[model samples]
Target: MSLPEPRDPSGPYRISVVCLGNICRSPMAEKVLTGELDRAGLSGAVEVASSGTGGWHIGSGMDSRAAALLRAHGYPTDHAARRFDPAHLAEHDLILAMDHANLDDLRRLARERADIGDRLRLFRTFAPDAGPSPEVPDPYYGGEHGFTTVLDMVHAAAKGLTAELAARYGSAL
Candidate 1:
């Protein structure tokens, strides 16, 4: 289960965002990040997707609030919730967990894939001044404010992540 480095620099840089349920945080991150990359003119160079650590919401649509928030921000809201598969380690260049619990779950799923350490990271790790809290809080049970807050956090981190990707694969892109 060894997580390999970006297999081919000339190929698309794959990214997978994960959370407890694919409907909220993960889908928002996915759409926001994809929008950021497209705005950066790096959409062709990057492949962004998301999934949940659990299977409960598999095949469902993104949470309504989450979809609405993304729509308001001019981001796409077309995403089908899916559970993260172990095989994703071999497919994606990076796996971003929205919170510590999801991060831990991904790591546990990695099992003996010791080499995956470099590729497994918290989504907020890319945010500027993220402080000690590296989570993109779940907004499903909260009010509209919660969804907006998650959007802000996701937008900030998506910008950072896009910049990092552009720097790393600019020429190839």
Candidate 2:
């Protein structure tokens, strides 16, 4: 099978996982994917990060409970929130969004339709067994369990995503 290099060879091999807000879903996705890659011994080969659809939380660390949840799950929790940039449309090799609205936002930023063609996909599309969960729910306004739920979804999706990456970019892994 052919695996896509999650990262670009000419650069740091970056994968910018994105959601509506950096604090919750996207960061959770980042941690899960990064952790899965780490388990596969591709930690250094995969450069993972998270950003938001809006600028409200830029330069902020993930929520405290979110950090705790990540640690509880034994995944790295370090992240700084930032809004999605138009340049990101060109920067990231793959852009995984939590929902269709965010996908539309990313698509709207594309300078050309081909710029986003087949690149931006729903995160749940890669989930191992999360049935019909199109987007990981935002846990920011809810209680701690919401964060855990988000983590659960993120972890499953990250696993499938990593395996896909390995197949797509066999030489890199």
Highest TM-score against the true fold, candidate: 1
Model 2 lDDT per residue over 32-121, tens place: 888888887777766887898999888898889889888887877888899998888777777888888888888778747564567777
Candidate 1 Cα errors over 4 Å, as ranges: 1-5
Candidate 2 backbone collisions, by pair: 2-167, 2-168, 3-167, 3-168, 3-169, 4-168, 4-169, 7-13
Model 2 misplacement above 4 A: 1-12, 111-113, 171-173
lDDT of each: 0.87, 0.78
lDDT of model 2 at position 111: 44
Error of 2 at 74 (Å): 1.8
Query: RMSD, each candidate, Å?
Result: 2.7, 2.4
Ten contiguous residues with the weakest lDDT in model 1: 1-10
* lDDT of candidate 2 at residue 71, scale 0 to 100: 88
Tell me how candidate 1 scores on lDDT: 0.87
Name the top lDDT candidate: 1
TM-score attained by model 1: 0.94
